[model samples]
Target: MLATPSDFDVLIVGAGISGIGMAAHLEMMCPRRSYAIVERRDQIGGTWDLFRYPGIRSDSDMHTLGFVFEPWRHEKSIADGPSILEYLNRIADERGIRPHIRFGYKVVSADFRPDEARWHVTVELADGERKLLTANFIYLGAGYYDYDDPYDAGFDFSEFEGDVIHPQFWPKDYDYTGKKVVVVGSGATAVTIVPSMADKAAHVTMLQRTPTWMFSRPAKDAIANFLRKVLPEKVAYAITRFKNITMQDFSFKAARNKPEKVKQALHKRIEKALGKDYDKEAFTPPYNPWEQRLCLVPDNDLFEAMKSGRASVVTGNIAKFEKDGVRLTSGELLPADIIVTATGLKLAIAGKIKISVAGEPVDFSQRYYYKGCMFSNLPNLAVVFGYLNASWTLRADINSEFVCRVLNHMEATGTNLATPVLTAEAEAKIEDDDLFDFSSGYIQRGKHIMPKSAKDYPWRLNQEYVFDRKVLRQGDVDDGLLSFTRAGANAMMAEEQLEAAE
Candidate 1:
């Protein structure tokens, strides 16, 4: 059965942080430009609402993580999962975006029509019923991970007596009180959960194949909190946000420039935190800083737990999972009643949705990215890929603003369509590189699935927020690369509709 197709000027997929942020921007910037957001899950918060694992928190500071328009109010910049979800919900409700959201709709496919200058989006609902939606423009905020298809590290723990858990789909009712918990993997999740679960569990063991760079920071931003009390909310937020961003930018550049010096300094910090008894070898990572995400420990919580003898770090390859715990390749057995796999997310490009142009399936890996927000040769479509170094919202904020500008530009001109088409010569000249330069287990596992990046501007992943802001926010939209055209009657539809609405 052909479902009722609701036509919108713009269609946003996923009601997560990025989608919601974009939706809010559309309302504020292009108020007359009608749009609807489709969320796969029933809930509004994407990762924040989904992950119910203990001690789930943002790796970056909330001052920068929070939306540019609305500053983070709380002192605790490194907020927990629930708090972040609450913040997103508040933004949705206050912006009157909740009514425009169609929950339980998973985008299955998007087919663009060059003739009509429109997209026909197909989404599957919870009841297996599929609906066809039409939109002039599509902004996919469907994050860079597959929530449904979590990355399985393929640990041979099939015969383990105790229950095994993945942080991606943490059970709501499960309790780990008084249980000996063994957390697998040494990414952000493992580092976070170890300290959190240690409080309730008998003891928590962080089992890692390799070490990650762990840096301790204050849980609360005292300066930001103090400024909020003294100055105007917006003023305080702006100052604090810049301060954090500058520090982060400097630190990342310094690390990249002097890898050994940065690595030694990081090791020294970890050594100081864990004392001389702790194996410094276990704290040293093989890869250089920024090659993988730097693990953030708020107030040295993870280290403090390890120092108190409540939590421990075990660096070894798992031989197999025994009835009680996991056995290492070195013949060491760590006893545990529960095992938590903190293996990183399965990196997804545009939420696994099948896209086609004129009935031909589009190969995203072949397509070049245009200024981080869009893809070359993809018409009227954009995907929000955030910063690999700084806060995700930093890039998201710029993306939303750029999208608004693009829509505005389309309306100003008689053209209703725009697509970034890379020239054959340009494509041939640009050297291809990994989409994300990180060497983490999950990224390495899914590197084949990720896009091949180009070397220069409008194609490469800069990894810096500053470069994105300049290119995406201030760069010319009608640059020679992007081709804009018009359909028959709808050529002036954008301008007309906006005028009519106004």
Candidate 2:
């Protein structure tokens, strides 16, 4: 059943931002060690390449999102998708990581062999051929969302004989110039699509089950623009990053502290923009602000679209699809030539790879996350996941740095194995109240895999840089779950006691 395998020191899954970042770090730190990046797609730039919705851009500014070593020279804070993809490609080229990338390679499964002390990975190539790769360690930089479209809930699309499209699979040759379009969902993608598509489409209608809190702000930072004119690109990037992060964090707190007052102010602004046409109650969301994400509109583009009569928001659940339109639950049918399903993404944890050790399944659902990097009982594996509040790359960069430190530590200690160990008592000390309570698919799926820590010590993500610096960056590399074994111990342990070996 086994075949000859290629070998490497490290094997990274996914060639997206995280994987590229990891590759950059690994190449810099461990040049002597061999590594390869396996990407399923023919090209890189994971989410950016996957999402083709009109006007799609970063929800957060590109400064902090960009790599620290490789400064992003984009003039706009919220850069477009093509620009971001280009930046990733540039980074990969600049760092010489492209040659090591195995494009059109998808890893099907991985198992940690206790006897061999290596991961036996089964990867399916673009051709119908399969191959194996043995590596000392595995890093899952695989993105969190599912690849297939999410709006496959068996909605009655046959009744509506008009064109229907999902953003994930947006057709390049689609002609929506003169057609009346109805876009469904209220996420960032929907917010972005409405404004851009409205500029061309005959009329655009935004259909939503619930309203998202929309905040309109300048797409380009005035100060950053001025800085770019005078200061160097790196200097401008740094200052703008600092300014954007401060403002975003402050806005997050502002919404949390004075929710009702802020909501009232936002409501007033919407009313002021729409005049008498603004239905006061129709645009309101039930939950506290940011409990679900707040949608950002660049330079009031969506608002301007609505004001210009190019776009209008319709708040109601879809009753069903009619012959030439969508019938809402509120006894109203909206005529449309095209319908765009902007439904939320389906989240797949660690890209849904089944990881097992010693022929026993590693119950990832039962495992707890440690520093959001490695899981309990999963050895020689590190995941680069970021914070929910800050830029994903910020946390990813830190995780990269931490991983380098860990590798360095392990190398210095002359050890080849390490994993987080959560004892029953340690796990029992965690409180459920301290965790993120959102019901989004991403959050809910993560809750099962993430660590539950008391607000103090090893279990908390305080959102403070200083605390993480001390806990994660400068923290002890050996806090117990990780055990080191030489060549002989692995074989002897497998022969004797496999369950307790780790």
lDDT of each: 0.86, 0.77
lDDT tens per residue, model 2, 429-502: 66644456554544665565554434554544445443565666777777655455544546454233224433
Q: Pick the candidate with the highest lDDT.
A: 1
Q: In model 1, which regions exceed 4 Å deviation?
A: 1-6, 489-502
Per-residue lDDT of model 1, residues 1-502, tens digit only: 1244339999999898899999999989999899999998999988888888999899999999999998898769999988899899999999999999999999999998766778999999999999999998999998888888788877888779998999998998789999999999999989989999999899999999899988888999999999999999999999999999999999999889999999888878877887867788788888889888899999999999988899999999989999899999999999999999887888888899999977888887777777888887678998887888899899889999998999999898867777776766667788876777788777777777666677778786668787778887778988877767676655464333323322
Model 2 clash pairs are 421-481
- What's the lDDT of the predicted structure labeled candidate 1? 0.86
Best by TM-score: 1
RMSD per candidate (Å) reads 4.8, 3.2
Where does candidate 2 stray beyond 4 Å? Answer: 1-6, 149-151, 268-277, 433-435, 441-457, 460-466, 480-502
Candidates in order, TM-scores: namely 0.95, 0.91
